[model samples]
Target: MHTTTSDTAPEQRTAAPRHPVARAGRISAQGAAALVLVLLLLVVVRLPWAGDLGMHAATVERLRHGLLHPGNPLIDADTPSPYYSPWTLLLGIVAKLTGLSVFVVLRLGALAGLALLVTGVHRYVRTLTAHRAAPALALLSLLFLWGPALFSWSGFLGLNSLALTVSYPSVCALGLTFHFWAWLTRAARGPIGWGAGAGLGVLWAVILLCHQFTGVVATLGGLAMVAGARPARATLLRLGTGLLPGLLVLWLWPYYDFFALFSAGGDLEAVHRSLYRDLAGRFGYVLLGVVALGFRLRRDRRDPLALFFALGVLMVAAGGLTGHYSWGRALPAALIPAQLAAALQAVSAGRWALRRGWACVLLVALVAGAWTQAGTLGYVVRRDALPGAVAAKYREPWAGYQWIVRAGVRYGDVVMARRFPARQIPAYGPYTVAPGYPDVFLPDADRREAAMKRYFEAGTGDGERRAILRAYGARWVVGGAPAPWLHKTAVGPRGQVLYRVAP
Candidate 1:
């Protein structure tokens, strides 16, 4: 009897190793964030949206009038340049065929890409979240999206900021980033894993043609991870093989460096003073939060993949600090992992708060605040933030040109305008313009300005507009609300205006 107590076996405990799917799938941070993403997406779907409207005006002007792009010649020719992507041109072609507004095409395309981005982000967070996070994760996902992707191209500074924005044929490179990072972290499954990588390579190539900045940043991100392990050549080859097609597409502009293209210039210091300040200021916070997070997740952070979330956050902070503090370019690339982590933490915190009582209120408050902010941001971007008009116009500039061609004028007649690009004439309609400024397509800015200016001045006379008409073969003069230069003929409701010259 006495021996029985001493010899008694301590309770036998066994745990089946958690299946990743079961772990990730069973209610996670990602699910919480994804819920918000879906909600925001639904709102983004319906809209009379516009952003970067002027760019579309410019692009459509060229396409509708068949004017060549004065700046870059590669787009005008069938042989694409590595610097110039065929995607926008193809979009223009499709818009012409479909009779959709160039803005419409672009806005719709961006919207679609955004939807996918949210889904991908949700998955990204799910891949990274360490435990069952459905409820909290769903909320966190919503919060993170509003701050990053949803607002990437919206508000004061966001993604799709036309200046830093890039696109390929039908995709926005940034939109697919979640999936790109997600795959690297996911336990590589069969064809699905391979497929994701292959697909990413294709999308990344398109990203280069569309928005080289984000693409470069993303590459930097992935490269940082790759350098750590110095993985086998086979893995590298797989990534390269999948990328070959896009690489060939990108090589279209061989003149742009295959290397040094992404390097910060020598004056990285002065070129972006504000960015540096912002980045430096945020560095403390970024380091504090991300590194602390690295520790918080240390028990589960055994995998190489975890570094991505932390690294992504830090890199974004770096971008904000170094570049012009462009939210699209600097923030999202790094915030990506942070966002994913936040969602998981929120959910984890939520469950803890529920169990722990009032002391957890502060923790839960942070979670709630973060989630609400994300949802609110998403709602804002979806409802009003994105210059949908601006984005569409930038994506397709043919709309701007259609006004010029539709003028009740004869063929072979020219239009007088200011700062109108001359290259898109061929794509737009049977029209021609003089003084191809910014004719990088031909040579350099000097050549472009010289040629365009000569053509512009030839037809104008102070005493008589007729002399100018005769010189440039102009049959009509046109202008729009956005173009204040044209006096006599201003654009109407249809976005066109025409002035009669000497017959």
Candidate 2:
């Protein structure tokens, strides 16, 4: 029988490897539980969409149609907008391919980005240490960090803000940058290839497309990675060459205008002030966590984790001073991965350095963290549970603007409104307000603001109104209270009236 089995042939002695799905199905209960925990965390962490989220959705929706590219829908519809990022382009493509509404696509896409970011951070932490608790601790640091989960002046709290509060482009950019760094870190340990170098360049370019500010942060982190590795000239050359595509994209698209806006004194001081205010309560905890982790890492200069965190902090500081609000806002996205690695190491070291009884207390603290996280998630969902809660919060009195869109206000029509800003209305209607808030940088912004002021004056006579309207070229007025001078064209769904300017 043994002879017969040997005669069967060498090939028959070994069975083909099981399909990945079959292997995956054989995962232990612990692995399965971990998977469930991750999935739950994804849902809990992603907050409801609001404000800029809606605007971004509307931008993508427009792009999906004949609009082709992104524009400030609330501003001059014809003029290019800074919203023309790789994220919007990808959202449009996904919507088209899946036949899903851009709104739905945006939500799902953001969720996917969140998932990618968490997984990338988890993998990176594991790479830093063999301690089993380190990975979970990393996640706990993120979940338990004292940050705004709903809305901040910059967006949402912590790293979640990038994916949820801010534009999806930033979220995707964060995820891409994290994955790229993770890959770069691994490749640095081995002999790198031309393919990886090219890939890094291409990835860098894509990050630029997603968000120029994020691109800057990625460059900083990537340089830190390279410095740590001290890679050969060929690798560095390839990385440099890879940036060409991104630079070309910047030249060809909205970045040219984006830089111009920032350079032209784009109310940067105000943005900087706002960013500082947001950072006050939110970032301090993250900094402390990173510091704790850094101390545990032996403060090694060559450590990639330390370098990455340091570079991230430097980039954030530079961004703040330079009036790069998005850069400053998105800096956390880059730092979170490193912060997690540090946290894991720090926590693991603490467990080892302490007595067994103290270890039990650490376990208790982790369980408490899990419980608190669940409660926090519950509070977040409950607070914004009502239908249109976010819309009511941000859109405010302009929640009725959709009626104007339904009433078929001319596309790109410039209307004067007291409540909703021009940019905010674009999410609900095809029309633009005369001169809304100074959110987006527009050419002739000073003149528009002045004209808007005159139009809203209590003593503004018909002649003055006409002159103001003529100056701003706005034909319609969306107001709450009826005006004797205005000829009512149509009543909106919410009983708000649209009036034609009587010359």
Candidate 3:
């Protein structure tokens, strides 16, 4: 129960004026943050389609049906998958016990993750600064400090990204990461019992098991915390002791080999290339935070935020230089520390005039960032109902393959689809001939991809197409054309046809 307080520096203790105007500003900031959270809650309830929603839902479905040995999440194969994370397992249990649909379970998970994120931010910020406004400012900065291109990725914690991926394991992992740092901050500063150390280790493992990429960010943050504290040898020993349980958990996780992923990076590097694109448009605004980080480093070379930022930059730069784009997932590590530093600098002890000026600049930047991501409103509102300007910001989510489900595609049925539809069909219980996403462990993933390609190729013979269908045991095919081997079952939106594989 030992909790860390904001005792690192005198600047952290600076208090805002008790003047009514200043008080009003603090209340307003908190209110704005609350409003944003409410908006996100509405989004969770609506559950707008984007990114990997289907994959996550498919994971829950698999676990709900067979928790102990849920096979491949997307394809009809008996293979372990990385998507079978601790968070998804819990959701699966809930889905089974309550008999709730996977999407409903996902909504509940999103709410839980959002709550964890909000509370974790509050707790972690308190360990950094005592200013009442620091937590709210930090939360706002974290959400709105990115550049204007509206990048939305799983591990990226920007407002648009979080809105789209609030239900993902990455969000839960990030929330847990904040709590881990808060606990680590206290443990590093003072002594603790062995039990506490072991618990910390378990928590670390859970975060890693929840989302591997976010786990990297968490690891970097932990290292920065310990390095900055210059803890006693006893403290470091306890930390080392804590690490054992974490590694054990990683080794024993039954869903997939966590350690094997290190060598599996080759398949992921190509898909993650997008993380390195449009640097200025996607993250240029964070430079303001980099400026703040510079100020922290000047005050104390061992500042945890400064060290955190440096480590993140090194990892991301190394990834970009070495063609290891998967490492780009760690961008949030650098982005987060910088964002928090900017917020802290705005509220830290300074000349009244200087603080006020910094606050104004931050406020303007936040507003601009918010505007850039206004498209997030599309999730909660009808896109057509929105004004043309707002509608323009909206990125349409996929219409989904539920139509085919209505056409009698049942659980365990194999469906042949192109990559895009394949990504979505598995969410409803049916499996794709090939996984829509990358699968490093699936030994025949290349063969499956090739077979799917041949089946769809214009020059493919009827005999070869039938052979491909027979090889994968596909019961249904989703495409625009009908062949002699296909019996048309149903027509979906956008001229999509669902055809039964004629036996």
Candidate 4:
């Protein structure tokens, strides 16, 4: 299939329009991007509590104290974990050398991740179109092209989601994924040397290790880039040759077993089932991008964006049908190409009438999207201080387990708490009786969870509860109920009490 001029262009041939309206629109998009970037910077400094923040923070804390043999992040177990990726290891090193708190290191990581994401988006979009506005427009589209319903997940690049998970390795992996695509697009156009190919392969593996779900999205995007290029036999050979070292890195990584995650899918399906819920409410706005993708398909039978969208769709659909709901994490692979296509089409459409129509439609969709996620403002601003309208949109963050930590919980001390508190307690350097999140590598996670449950059960005798605490060596407990074996030490913001387990 013949490539479109927009795709093959080495640089933007047309000077930016001097028309007042066009200039204004470009300025508006760029301004919106700048504002969102500033908001994200504030969010990083604030580091609001949300999904997996504690898990990630705990991982960094463990690594800071003991990089070589950092045990399971959430519980008192000497087991390897998937959380100790290259990204976290680097942050851990920084924390150790600088004597920075784990949260401070996380703030730095968030800044780096946000920077990578911005630069990567600009570079990748430039490959798709020469329009000067394409980069800014694409960035805005990626952030605001979803449906009116609010949705936030690690790999999903929606503005609201990015604000919540800016510190996560998933964000860093996604940033690298964009840069990978841009580099691959350039290399596939001509001969690639062995060194470049091998380096590319290593980068790919690093992304997977950082965040396995985003890694799948990266793979799909990379395949789309390669398939669309139809590279020469020698180019293909070099690419395949480079892949070996990358696979080796995955196999040899001492932190965790990268390959074991495939068999571990059964453990994750339950937690990920929500990825399939309210699909239309969460992603319906992407139909505009889908329409734009249709245009690209009509122009080039093997358009990279179309191929990327198809591959993502196939994966997500198979997941929903085959009961492998975890594959829903690959939703970004489908959403991203369509979003970019819409942004590119707005500027590159051949006819003036077509361009005007598409741009206007996109503007409306983006405005609606921004409004839907207005609650994100609460991350940096006080909810009570925000305007009533914005306050209503806000979803409050967790108050955290600092109250427990402040009362003198120390590293490696196991605390018995139910699930919610279990999630946050470890962030402050203590372990919970049960792992707050799924732990594929922890051998006794299930038994630990059952013990925690039985301890809290109304019918359980004090003897069994004490046995449970002793079995896990739990030194503290977070609950309201009083027991003869518990000595209350501190009360939490939500009225939960911290108790020292009597010896």
Global lDDT of model 2? 0.55
lDDT of 1 at 166: 22
Clashes (backbone N, CA, C under 3 Å), per candidate, total 83, 0, 0, 0
Regions of model 3 farther than 4 Å from truth: 1-11
C-alpha TM-score for every candidate: 0.56, 0.74, 0.97, 0.97
Local accuracy of candidate 4 as per-residue lDDT tens digits, 303-408: 8899999999999999999999999999999999999998988887476677878999999999989988999999999989999988999998888988887898
Give lDDT: candidate 1, residue 311: 56
Work out candidate 1's RMSD over C-alphas.
10.5
Error of 3 at 10 (Å): 4.6
Model 3 pairs in collision: none
Estimate candidate 4's alpha-carbon lDDT, on a 0 to 1 scale.
Answer: 0.90
Q: How close is candidate 1 to the true structure, as a TM-score?
A: 0.56
lDDT of 2 by residue, 330-383 (tens): 555444644465344333433333423433443344343333233333323444
Error of 1 at 314 (Å): 8.1
Q: Quick one: ranking by TM-score, best first?
A: 3, 4, 2, 1
Model 4 clash pairs are none
Across 439-465, the per-residue lDDT of candidate 3 in tens digits comes to: 988999998998888889899888888
